[model samples]
Target: MSSNQQSDNVLSLRGISKTFGAVAALTDIDLDVAAGQVVAIVGDNGAGKSTLVKILSGVHPPDSGKIVFDSKTVEIPTPAAAHRLGIATVFQDLALCENLNVIQNLFLGQELRPLRLNDVAMETRSWDLLRQLSAKIPSVRVPVASLSGGQRQTVAIARSLLGDPKVIILDEPTAALGVAQTAEVLNLVERLRERGLGVIMISHNMADVKAVADTVAVLRLGRNNGVFDVNDVSPEDIIAAITGATDNAVSQRQARRKEGLSS
Candidate 1:
Protein backbone atom coordinates (compact mmCIF):
# COMPACT_ATOMS: atom_id res chain seq x y z
CA MET A 1 0.00 0.00 0.00
CA SER A 2 1.11 3.57 -0.61
CA SER A 3 2.07 6.07 2.06
CA ASN A 4 -1.21 7.85 1.56
CA GLN A 5 -3.10 4.66 2.21
CA GLN A 6 -0.99 3.94 5.27
CA SER A 7 -1.71 7.43 6.51
CA ASP A 8 -5.34 6.37 6.66
CA ASN A 9 -4.59 3.65 9.18
CA VAL A 10 -7.64 2.74 11.28
CA LEU A 11 -5.77 1.68 14.38
CA SER A 12 -2.42 2.55 15.95
CA LEU A 13 -0.65 1.78 19.21
CA ARG A 14 2.34 3.62 20.68
CA GLY A 15 4.29 2.82 23.82
CA ILE A 16 1.58 0.43 25.02
CA SER A 17 2.58 -1.47 28.13
CA LYS A 18 0.65 -3.76 30.44
CA THR A 19 1.58 -5.54 33.65
CA PHE A 20 -0.16 -8.03 35.87
CA GLY A 21 1.19 -7.55 39.40
CA ALA A 22 4.96 -8.03 38.99
CA VAL A 23 4.87 -9.70 35.59
CA ALA A 24 5.20 -7.29 32.70
CA ALA A 25 2.99 -8.62 29.93
CA LEU A 26 3.87 -5.94 27.40
CA THR A 27 6.59 -3.32 27.07
CA ASP A 28 6.50 -0.24 24.92
CA ILE A 29 4.74 -2.03 22.08
CA ASP A 30 3.87 -0.20 18.88
CA LEU A 31 1.63 -1.36 16.05
CA ASP A 32 -0.37 -0.06 13.11
CA VAL A 33 -3.23 -1.47 11.03
CA ALA A 34 -4.04 0.32 7.82
CA ALA A 35 -7.28 0.28 5.90
CA GLY A 36 -7.64 -2.64 3.48
CA GLN A 37 -4.61 -4.33 5.03
CA VAL A 38 -4.18 -7.49 7.05
CA VAL A 39 -1.58 -7.42 9.85
CA ALA A 40 -0.80 -10.77 11.42
CA ILE A 41 0.61 -10.98 14.94
CA VAL A 42 2.75 -14.07 15.41
CA GLY A 43 4.46 -15.16 18.56
CA ASP A 44 5.29 -18.13 20.71
CA ASN A 45 3.46 -18.94 23.94
CA GLY A 46 3.73 -16.31 26.72
CA ALA A 47 4.74 -13.80 24.05
CA GLY A 48 1.93 -11.45 25.24
CA LYS A 49 -0.18 -11.86 22.12
CA SER A 50 -3.32 -12.52 24.15
CA THR A 51 -2.60 -9.60 26.43
CA LEU A 52 -2.26 -7.28 23.48
CA VAL A 53 -5.55 -8.49 22.04
CA LYS A 54 -7.25 -8.00 25.38
CA ILE A 55 -5.91 -4.48 25.56
CA LEU A 56 -7.19 -3.71 22.09
CA SER A 57 -10.61 -5.17 22.77
CA GLY A 58 -10.95 -3.32 26.08
CA VAL A 59 -11.05 -6.53 28.05
CA HIS A 60 -8.05 -5.24 29.96
CA PRO A 61 -7.07 -1.63 30.25
CA PRO A 62 -3.46 -0.86 29.42
CA ASP A 63 -1.25 0.14 32.30
CA SER A 64 0.35 2.84 30.22
CA GLY A 65 0.40 3.95 26.57
CA LYS A 66 -1.73 5.49 23.91
CA ILE A 67 -4.30 3.84 21.65
CA VAL A 68 -5.10 5.77 18.51
CA PHE A 69 -8.25 4.86 16.64
CA ASP A 70 -9.11 6.67 13.45
CA SER A 71 -6.44 9.31 14.11
CA LYS A 72 -7.68 10.15 17.61
CA THR A 73 -6.17 9.01 20.87
CA VAL A 74 -8.89 7.13 22.75
CA GLU A 75 -9.44 5.25 25.96
CA ILE A 76 -11.03 1.82 25.78
CA PRO A 77 -12.14 1.10 29.32
CA THR A 78 -14.57 -1.69 28.56
CA PRO A 79 -15.87 -3.98 25.83
CA ALA A 80 -18.82 -1.69 25.17
CA ALA A 81 -16.43 1.22 24.70
CA ALA A 82 -14.45 -0.78 22.19
CA HIS A 83 -17.60 -1.64 20.24
CA ARG A 84 -18.79 1.94 20.32
CA LEU A 85 -15.41 2.98 18.93
CA GLY A 86 -15.87 0.70 15.93
CA ILE A 87 -13.56 -2.09 17.12
CA ALA A 88 -14.73 -5.70 17.21
CA THR A 89 -12.95 -8.88 18.22
CA VAL A 90 -13.87 -12.49 17.56
CA PHE A 91 -12.12 -14.76 19.98
CA GLN A 92 -11.25 -18.41 19.45
CA ASP A 93 -14.23 -19.65 21.47
CA LEU A 94 -16.61 -17.77 19.07
CA ALA A 95 -19.14 -17.35 21.96
CA LEU A 96 -22.04 -18.27 19.72
CA CYS A 97 -25.38 -19.66 20.92
CA GLU A 98 -25.31 -23.22 19.68
CA ASN A 99 -29.09 -23.61 19.93
CA LEU A 100 -29.84 -20.51 17.88
CA ASN A 101 -29.98 -20.36 14.13
CA VAL A 102 -27.80 -18.10 11.98
CA ILE A 103 -30.17 -15.16 11.91
CA GLN A 104 -31.08 -15.42 15.58
CA ASN A 105 -27.43 -15.75 16.63
CA LEU A 106 -26.42 -12.78 14.54
CA PHE A 107 -28.89 -10.52 16.29
CA LEU A 108 -28.86 -12.15 19.69
CA GLY A 109 -28.16 -9.60 22.40
CA GLN A 110 -28.48 -6.53 20.20
CA GLU A 111 -31.75 -7.63 18.74
CA LEU A 112 -34.30 -5.10 17.59
CA ARG A 113 -36.08 -5.48 20.91
CA PRO A 114 -38.89 -3.34 22.38
CA LEU A 115 -39.86 -2.45 18.82
CA ARG A 116 -41.61 -5.64 17.66
CA LEU A 117 -38.21 -7.18 16.64
CA ASN A 118 -37.87 -6.80 12.88
CA ASP A 119 -37.29 -10.45 12.05
CA VAL A 120 -37.86 -9.85 8.36
CA ALA A 121 -35.31 -7.04 8.12
CA MET A 122 -32.83 -8.79 10.42
CA GLU A 123 -32.98 -12.04 8.45
CA THR A 124 -32.63 -10.15 5.22
CA ARG A 125 -29.51 -8.39 6.46
CA SER A 126 -28.10 -11.63 7.75
CA TRP A 127 -28.38 -13.19 4.30
CA ASP A 128 -26.92 -10.07 2.78
CA LEU A 129 -23.93 -10.23 5.11
CA LEU A 130 -23.35 -13.93 4.41
CA ARG A 131 -23.56 -13.29 0.68
CA GLN A 132 -21.05 -10.47 0.98
CA LEU A 133 -18.56 -12.79 2.63
CA SER A 134 -19.29 -15.55 0.10
CA ALA A 135 -20.13 -17.77 3.02
CA LYS A 136 -21.38 -21.26 2.22
CA ILE A 137 -24.19 -22.08 4.58
CA PRO A 138 -27.07 -24.15 3.29
CA SER A 139 -29.64 -22.34 5.36
CA VAL A 140 -29.92 -19.44 7.84
CA ARG A 141 -32.64 -21.21 9.80
CA VAL A 142 -30.44 -24.09 10.94
CA PRO A 143 -28.92 -24.16 14.42
CA VAL A 144 -25.25 -23.25 14.75
CA ALA A 145 -24.59 -26.72 16.20
CA SER A 146 -25.06 -28.19 12.76
CA LEU A 147 -22.53 -25.94 11.04
CA SER A 148 -18.99 -27.03 10.30
CA GLY A 149 -16.02 -25.45 12.02
CA GLY A 150 -15.32 -23.14 9.09
CA GLN A 151 -18.98 -22.21 8.76
CA ARG A 152 -19.10 -21.34 12.45
CA GLN A 153 -16.04 -19.18 11.96
CA THR A 154 -17.76 -17.36 9.11
CA VAL A 155 -20.79 -16.73 11.30
CA ALA A 156 -18.65 -15.37 14.14
CA ILE A 157 -16.90 -13.06 11.68
CA ALA A 158 -20.15 -11.98 10.08
CA ARG A 159 -21.67 -11.20 13.47
CA SER A 160 -18.73 -8.99 14.33
CA LEU A 161 -19.46 -6.96 11.20
CA LEU A 162 -22.95 -6.10 12.43
CA GLY A 163 -21.39 -3.21 14.36
CA ASP A 164 -19.77 -1.99 11.15
CA PRO A 165 -16.39 -1.90 12.83
CA LYS A 166 -13.45 -0.23 11.16
CA VAL A 167 -10.99 -2.71 12.67
CA ILE A 168 -11.64 -6.40 13.35
CA ILE A 169 -9.43 -8.80 15.26
CA LEU A 170 -9.50 -12.52 14.61
CA ASP A 171 -7.93 -14.90 17.13
CA GLU A 172 -6.82 -18.19 15.60
CA PRO A 173 -9.59 -18.04 13.00
CA THR A 174 -8.53 -21.22 11.22
CA ALA A 175 -7.86 -23.27 14.31
CA ALA A 176 -9.10 -26.89 14.21
CA LEU A 177 -10.31 -26.45 10.65
CA GLY A 178 -9.69 -29.01 7.91
CA VAL A 179 -7.74 -28.02 4.79
CA ALA A 180 -10.86 -27.08 2.84
CA GLN A 181 -12.44 -25.35 5.80
CA THR A 182 -9.27 -23.36 6.41
CA ALA A 183 -9.37 -22.12 2.84
CA GLU A 184 -12.94 -20.98 3.31
CA VAL A 185 -12.06 -18.87 6.34
CA LEU A 186 -9.03 -17.38 4.60
CA ASN A 187 -11.23 -16.32 1.69
CA LEU A 188 -13.51 -14.49 4.12
CA VAL A 189 -10.49 -12.67 5.50
CA GLU A 190 -9.61 -11.43 2.03
CA ARG A 191 -13.15 -10.18 1.61
CA LEU A 192 -12.79 -8.12 4.79
CA ARG A 193 -9.69 -6.47 3.30
CA GLU A 194 -11.45 -5.88 0.00
CA ARG A 195 -14.12 -3.98 1.92
CA GLY A 196 -11.43 -1.58 3.17
CA LEU A 197 -11.51 -2.87 6.74
CA GLY A 198 -8.36 -3.10 8.80
CA VAL A 199 -7.72 -6.66 10.01
CA ILE A 200 -5.49 -7.70 12.89
CA MET A 201 -5.22 -11.45 13.01
CA ILE A 202 -3.48 -13.39 15.76
CA SER A 203 -2.43 -16.68 14.24
CA HIS A 204 0.27 -19.26 14.78
CA ASN A 205 -0.11 -20.81 11.33
CA MET A 206 2.72 -19.51 9.20
CA ALA A 207 1.15 -20.65 5.94
CA ASP A 208 -2.06 -18.79 6.70
CA VAL A 209 -0.13 -15.69 7.68
CA LYS A 210 2.00 -15.82 4.56
CA ALA A 211 -1.06 -16.29 2.40
CA VAL A 212 -3.13 -13.36 3.69
CA ALA A 213 -1.08 -10.99 5.79
CA ASP A 214 0.34 -7.85 4.24
CA THR A 215 2.57 -7.37 7.29
CA VAL A 216 3.68 -9.56 10.17
CA ALA A 217 4.61 -8.32 13.63
CA VAL A 218 6.63 -10.62 15.84
CA LEU A 219 6.39 -10.42 19.61
CA ARG A 220 8.96 -11.89 21.97
CA LEU A 221 8.86 -11.82 25.79
CA GLY A 222 6.19 -9.11 25.75
CA ARG A 223 8.06 -6.63 23.59
CA ASN A 224 8.02 -5.56 19.99
CA ASN A 225 10.77 -7.73 18.57
CA GLY A 226 10.28 -7.01 14.89
CA VAL A 227 7.86 -5.99 12.15
CA PHE A 228 8.29 -7.17 8.56
CA ASP A 229 6.64 -6.70 5.22
CA VAL A 230 5.25 -10.08 4.16
CA ASN A 231 6.57 -9.71 0.60
CA ASP A 232 10.00 -8.54 1.67
CA VAL A 233 10.94 -10.92 4.51
CA SER A 234 11.52 -14.65 4.44
CA PRO A 235 9.80 -17.06 6.81
CA GLU A 236 13.18 -17.90 8.35
CA ASP A 237 13.70 -14.28 9.36
CA ILE A 238 10.26 -14.11 10.96
CA ILE A 239 10.85 -17.35 12.83
CA ALA A 240 14.18 -16.02 14.04
CA ALA A 241 12.45 -12.98 15.41
CA ILE A 242 9.75 -15.05 17.12
CA THR A 243 12.39 -17.24 18.77
CA GLY A 244 14.53 -14.23 19.71
CA ALA A 245 17.44 -15.91 17.98
CA THR A 246 18.18 -13.56 15.13
CA ASP A 247 21.62 -12.89 16.63
CA ASN A 248 22.26 -16.38 18.00
CA ALA A 249 25.33 -18.44 17.11
CA VAL A 250 23.57 -20.35 14.32
CA SER A 251 22.27 -17.16 12.72
CA GLN A 252 25.67 -15.50 13.07
CA ARG A 253 27.35 -18.44 11.36
CA GLN A 254 24.81 -18.34 8.54
CA ALA A 255 25.43 -14.60 8.16
CA ARG A 256 29.16 -15.12 8.00
CA ARG A 257 28.72 -17.81 5.34
CA LYS A 258 26.64 -15.45 3.23
CA GLU A 259 29.22 -12.69 3.68
CA GLY A 260 32.03 -15.04 2.64
CA LEU A 261 30.06 -16.16 -0.40
CA SER A 262 29.55 -12.51 -1.44
CA SER A 263 33.24 -11.73 -0.99
Candidate 2:
Protein backbone atom coordinates (compact mmCIF):
# COMPACT_ATOMS: atom_id res chain seq x y z
CA MET A 1 0.00 0.00 0.00
CA SER A 2 1.15 3.52 -0.74
CA SER A 3 1.83 5.72 2.28
CA ASN A 4 0.22 8.96 1.25
CA GLN A 5 1.25 11.23 4.08
CA GLN A 6 -1.78 13.26 5.14
CA SER A 7 -1.39 16.37 7.28
CA ASP A 8 -4.13 15.24 9.63
CA ASN A 9 -2.77 11.77 10.26
CA VAL A 10 -1.52 11.35 13.81
CA LEU A 11 0.02 7.91 13.18
CA SER A 12 1.43 6.48 9.95
CA LEU A 13 3.18 3.19 9.19
CA ARG A 14 5.10 2.68 5.98
CA GLY A 15 6.93 -0.37 4.70
CA ILE A 16 6.60 -2.09 8.05
CA SER A 17 8.00 -5.61 7.96
CA LYS A 18 9.01 -8.12 10.60
CA THR A 19 10.56 -11.57 10.45
CA PHE A 20 11.11 -14.36 12.96
CA GLY A 21 14.07 -16.42 11.74
CA ALA A 22 12.61 -18.36 8.77
CA VAL A 23 9.02 -17.03 8.88
CA ALA A 24 8.05 -13.60 7.59
CA ALA A 25 5.30 -12.30 9.91
CA LEU A 26 4.62 -8.95 8.21
CA THR A 27 5.69 -7.45 4.90
CA ASP A 28 5.41 -3.87 3.72
CA ILE A 29 2.32 -2.91 5.75
CA ASP A 30 1.03 0.65 5.51
CA LEU A 31 -1.62 2.30 7.65
CA ASP A 32 -2.65 5.84 8.62
CA VAL A 33 -4.77 7.05 11.53
CA ALA A 34 -6.02 10.59 11.91
CA ALA A 35 -6.93 12.46 15.03
CA GLY A 36 -10.50 12.01 16.28
CA GLN A 37 -10.99 9.01 13.96
CA VAL A 38 -11.35 5.32 14.70
CA VAL A 39 -9.33 3.04 12.41
CA ALA A 40 -10.28 -0.61 12.81
CA ILE A 41 -7.67 -3.23 11.89
CA VAL A 42 -9.34 -6.49 10.89
CA GLY A 43 -7.71 -9.74 9.85
CA ASP A 44 -7.94 -13.46 10.41
CA ASN A 45 -5.62 -15.20 12.86
CA GLY A 46 -1.91 -15.20 11.85
CA ALA A 47 -2.58 -12.36 9.45
CA GLY A 48 0.05 -10.43 11.49
CA LYS A 49 -2.44 -8.48 13.61
CA SER A 50 -0.74 -9.55 16.86
CA THR A 51 2.71 -8.86 15.42
CA LEU A 52 1.67 -5.39 14.31
CA VAL A 53 0.23 -4.60 17.71
CA LYS A 54 3.43 -5.75 19.40
CA ILE A 55 5.42 -3.40 17.20
CA LEU A 56 3.25 -0.44 18.15
CA SER A 57 3.24 -1.42 21.81
CA GLY A 58 7.07 -1.68 21.90
CA VAL A 59 6.95 -5.36 22.85
CA HIS A 60 8.80 -6.09 19.60
CA PRO A 61 10.57 -3.80 17.16
CA PRO A 62 9.79 -4.12 13.47
CA ASP A 63 12.62 -5.50 11.37
CA SER A 64 12.03 -2.72 8.85
CA GLY A 65 9.54 0.16 8.82
CA LYS A 66 8.89 3.81 9.45
CA ILE A 67 6.61 4.76 12.35
CA VAL A 68 5.69 8.41 12.24
CA PHE A 69 3.95 9.71 15.35
CA ASP A 70 2.85 13.31 15.66
CA SER A 71 4.56 14.06 12.35
CA LYS A 72 7.98 12.90 13.54
CA THR A 73 9.65 9.57 12.80
CA VAL A 74 10.44 7.88 16.12
CA GLU A 75 11.61 4.64 17.62
CA ILE A 76 9.72 2.80 20.35
CA PRO A 77 12.36 0.57 21.88
CA THR A 78 10.39 -0.16 25.05
CA PRO A 79 6.90 0.20 26.55
CA ALA A 80 8.12 3.37 28.28
CA ALA A 81 9.25 4.78 24.95
CA ALA A 82 5.85 4.14 23.38
CA HIS A 83 4.06 5.90 26.25
CA ARG A 84 6.55 8.72 26.13
CA LEU A 85 5.74 9.18 22.46
CA GLY A 86 1.99 9.52 23.25
CA ILE A 87 1.13 6.02 21.99
CA ALA A 88 -0.74 3.81 24.44
CA THR A 89 -1.84 0.23 23.82
CA VAL A 90 -4.37 -1.71 25.85
CA PHE A 91 -4.06 -5.41 25.12
CA GLN A 92 -6.94 -7.92 25.35
CA ASP A 93 -5.94 -9.17 28.81
CA LEU A 94 -6.06 -5.54 30.19
CA ALA A 95 -3.13 -6.21 32.62
CA LEU A 96 -5.18 -4.95 35.53
CA CYS A 97 -4.67 -6.42 38.97
CA GLU A 98 -7.84 -8.19 40.05
CA ASN A 99 -7.21 -7.44 43.71
CA LEU A 100 -6.75 -3.72 43.12
CA ASN A 101 -9.55 -1.16 42.93
CA VAL A 102 -10.04 1.23 40.04
CA ILE A 103 -7.99 3.97 41.69
CA GLN A 104 -5.15 1.65 42.52
CA ASN A 105 -5.05 0.13 39.05
CA LEU A 106 -5.09 3.49 37.28
CA PHE A 107 -2.05 4.71 39.17
CA LEU A 108 -0.43 1.34 39.79
CA GLY A 109 3.25 2.16 39.28
CA GLN A 110 3.00 5.84 38.43
CA GLU A 111 1.39 6.91 41.63
CA LEU A 112 1.21 10.48 42.88
CA ARG A 113 3.71 11.26 45.63
CA PRO A 114 5.18 7.78 45.78
CA LEU A 115 6.91 8.50 49.08
CA ARG A 116 3.94 10.18 50.71
CA LEU A 117 1.27 8.23 48.75
CA ASN A 118 -1.41 10.79 47.98
CA ASP A 119 -4.64 8.83 48.23
CA VAL A 120 -7.04 11.77 47.87
CA ALA A 121 -5.30 13.14 44.80
CA MET A 122 -5.19 9.77 43.04
CA GLU A 123 -8.85 9.10 43.84
CA THR A 124 -9.89 12.52 42.56
CA ARG A 125 -7.92 12.03 39.30
CA SER A 126 -9.40 8.57 38.86
CA TRP A 127 -12.93 9.94 39.20
CA ASP A 128 -12.15 12.69 36.72
CA LEU A 129 -10.90 10.21 34.10
CA LEU A 130 -13.89 7.90 34.54
CA ARG A 131 -16.26 10.82 34.35
CA GLN A 132 -14.63 12.02 31.14
CA LEU A 133 -15.27 8.61 29.58
CA SER A 134 -18.76 8.52 31.12
CA ALA A 135 -17.85 5.20 32.64
CA LYS A 136 -20.54 3.40 34.62
CA ILE A 137 -19.00 2.10 37.77
CA PRO A 138 -20.67 2.37 41.16
CA SER A 139 -17.45 3.22 42.93
CA VAL A 140 -13.75 3.68 42.23
CA ARG A 141 -13.03 1.88 45.46
CA VAL A 142 -14.51 -1.38 44.16
CA PRO A 143 -12.10 -4.16 43.25
CA VAL A 144 -11.50 -4.76 39.55
CA ALA A 145 -12.70 -8.35 39.93
CA SER A 146 -16.10 -7.04 40.99
CA LEU A 147 -16.56 -5.15 37.73
CA SER A 148 -18.29 -6.58 34.69
CA GLY A 149 -16.51 -7.24 31.39
CA GLY A 150 -17.53 -3.90 29.93
CA GLN A 151 -16.68 -2.04 33.12
CA ARG A 152 -13.23 -3.59 33.16
CA GLN A 153 -12.71 -2.47 29.59
CA THR A 154 -13.79 1.02 30.54
CA VAL A 155 -11.26 1.05 33.35
CA ALA A 156 -8.51 -0.16 31.08
CA ILE A 157 -9.27 2.50 28.48
CA ALA A 158 -9.60 5.25 31.08
CA ARG A 159 -6.24 4.31 32.51
CA SER A 160 -4.68 4.64 29.07
CA LEU A 161 -6.05 8.15 28.81
CA LEU A 162 -4.23 9.24 31.96
CA GLY A 163 -1.10 9.62 29.84
CA ASP A 164 -2.91 12.00 27.46
CA PRO A 165 -1.93 9.89 24.47
CA LYS A 166 -2.36 11.17 20.94
CA VAL A 167 -3.22 7.67 19.73
CA ILE A 168 -4.66 4.61 21.49
CA ILE A 169 -4.58 1.04 20.20
CA LEU A 170 -7.25 -1.32 21.53
CA ASP A 171 -6.91 -5.06 20.96
CA GLU A 172 -10.30 -6.79 20.60
CA PRO A 173 -12.16 -4.21 22.70
CA THR A 174 -15.53 -5.93 22.41
CA ALA A 175 -14.49 -9.56 22.19
CA ALA A 176 -16.40 -12.03 24.38
CA LEU A 177 -18.77 -9.26 25.43
CA GLY A 178 -22.54 -9.73 25.44
CA VAL A 179 -24.73 -7.57 23.20
CA ALA A 180 -25.41 -4.92 25.81
CA GLN A 181 -21.84 -4.97 27.09
CA THR A 182 -20.55 -4.65 23.56
CA ALA A 183 -22.73 -1.62 23.02
CA GLU A 184 -21.31 -0.03 26.16
CA VAL A 185 -17.74 -0.50 24.94
CA LEU A 186 -18.66 0.83 21.51
CA ASN A 187 -20.05 3.99 23.11
CA LEU A 188 -16.76 4.47 24.94
CA VAL A 189 -14.92 4.15 21.66
CA GLU A 190 -17.08 6.97 20.28
CA ARG A 191 -16.25 9.08 23.30
CA LEU A 192 -12.56 8.62 22.59
CA ARG A 193 -13.05 9.94 19.07
CA GLU A 194 -14.94 12.94 20.40
CA ARG A 195 -11.99 13.63 22.68
CA GLY A 196 -9.87 14.03 19.53
CA LEU A 197 -7.77 10.95 20.15
CA GLY A 198 -6.72 8.79 17.23
CA VAL A 199 -7.93 5.24 17.87
CA ILE A 200 -6.70 2.04 16.24
CA MET A 201 -9.12 -0.74 17.18
CA ILE A 202 -8.19 -4.32 16.36
CA SER A 203 -11.41 -6.27 16.20
CA HIS A 204 -12.86 -9.38 14.51
CA ASN A 205 -16.46 -8.14 14.80
CA MET A 206 -17.51 -6.26 11.69
CA ALA A 207 -20.69 -5.02 13.36
CA ASP A 208 -18.72 -3.22 16.06
CA VAL A 209 -16.34 -1.86 13.44
CA LYS A 210 -19.20 -0.45 11.37
CA ALA A 211 -20.76 1.05 14.46
CA VAL A 212 -17.72 3.10 15.52
CA ALA A 213 -14.90 2.96 12.97
CA ASP A 214 -14.42 5.69 10.38
CA THR A 215 -12.06 3.48 8.34
CA VAL A 216 -11.23 -0.21 8.13
CA ALA A 217 -7.68 -1.47 7.40
CA VAL A 218 -7.51 -5.09 6.35
CA LEU A 219 -4.34 -7.21 6.47
CA ARG A 220 -4.14 -10.42 4.44
CA LEU A 221 -1.22 -12.88 4.68
CA GLY A 222 0.98 -10.18 6.27
CA ARG A 223 0.32 -7.62 3.55
CA ASN A 224 -2.05 -4.72 3.03
CA ASN A 225 -5.19 -5.95 1.27
CA GLY A 226 -7.24 -2.76 1.40
CA VAL A 227 -8.23 0.31 3.33
CA PHE A 228 -11.90 1.27 3.08
CA ASP A 229 -14.27 3.93 4.27
CA VAL A 230 -16.60 2.24 6.71
CA ASN A 231 -19.59 4.16 5.33
CA ASP A 232 -19.06 2.92 1.77
CA VAL A 233 -17.83 -0.67 2.20
CA SER A 234 -20.00 -3.65 3.10
CA PRO A 235 -18.95 -6.23 5.68
CA GLU A 236 -18.75 -8.86 2.94
CA ASP A 237 -16.28 -6.73 0.98
CA ILE A 238 -14.05 -6.46 4.01
CA ILE A 239 -14.33 -10.21 4.65
CA ALA A 240 -13.45 -10.98 1.02
CA ALA A 241 -10.28 -8.93 1.37
CA ILE A 242 -9.47 -10.68 4.63
CA THR A 243 -9.91 -14.21 3.24
CA GLY A 244 -8.27 -13.12 -0.07
CA ALA A 245 -11.11 -14.20 -2.37
CA THR A 246 -14.69 -13.40 -3.37
CA ASP A 247 -15.43 -17.04 -4.24
CA ASN A 248 -15.72 -18.01 -0.58
CA ALA A 249 -18.96 -19.42 0.92
CA VAL A 250 -20.42 -16.07 2.00
CA SER A 251 -19.96 -14.36 -1.36
CA GLN A 252 -21.13 -17.44 -3.27
CA ARG A 253 -24.30 -17.66 -1.20
CA GLN A 254 -24.99 -13.98 -1.72
CA ALA A 255 -24.36 -14.32 -5.45
CA ARG A 256 -26.77 -17.25 -5.76
CA ARG A 257 -29.42 -15.40 -3.78
CA LYS A 258 -29.03 -12.37 -6.00
CA GLU A 259 -29.41 -14.56 -9.12
CA GLY A 260 -32.57 -16.11 -7.73
CA LEU A 261 -34.00 -12.67 -6.97
CA SER A 262 -33.31 -11.38 -10.50
CA SER A 263 -34.85 -14.53 -12.04
- Residue 95 local lDDT, model 2: 91
Q: Rate the local accuracy (lDDT) of all candidates.
A: 0.94, 0.94
What is every candidate's alpha-carbon RMSD to the true fold? 3.3, 1.7
Candidate 2 residue-wise lDDT, 1-263, digit = tens: 33554868999999999999988999999999999999999999999999999999899999999999888999888989999999999999999999999999999889999899999999999999999888899999989999999999999999999999999999999997899889999999999999999999999999999999999999998999999999999999999999999889989988999999999
Predicted candidate 1 versus true structure: per-residue lDDT over 20-132, tens digit per residue = 99999999999999999999999999999999999999999999999999989999999999999999999999999999999999998888754798988899999999999
What would the TM-scores of all predictions be?
Answer: 0.92, 0.97
Q: Which pairs clash in model 2?
A: none
Q: Which ten residues in a row have the lowest lDDT in candidate 2?
A: 1-10
Alpha-carbon error at 136 in model 1, in Å? 0.3
> How many collisions per candidate?
0, 0
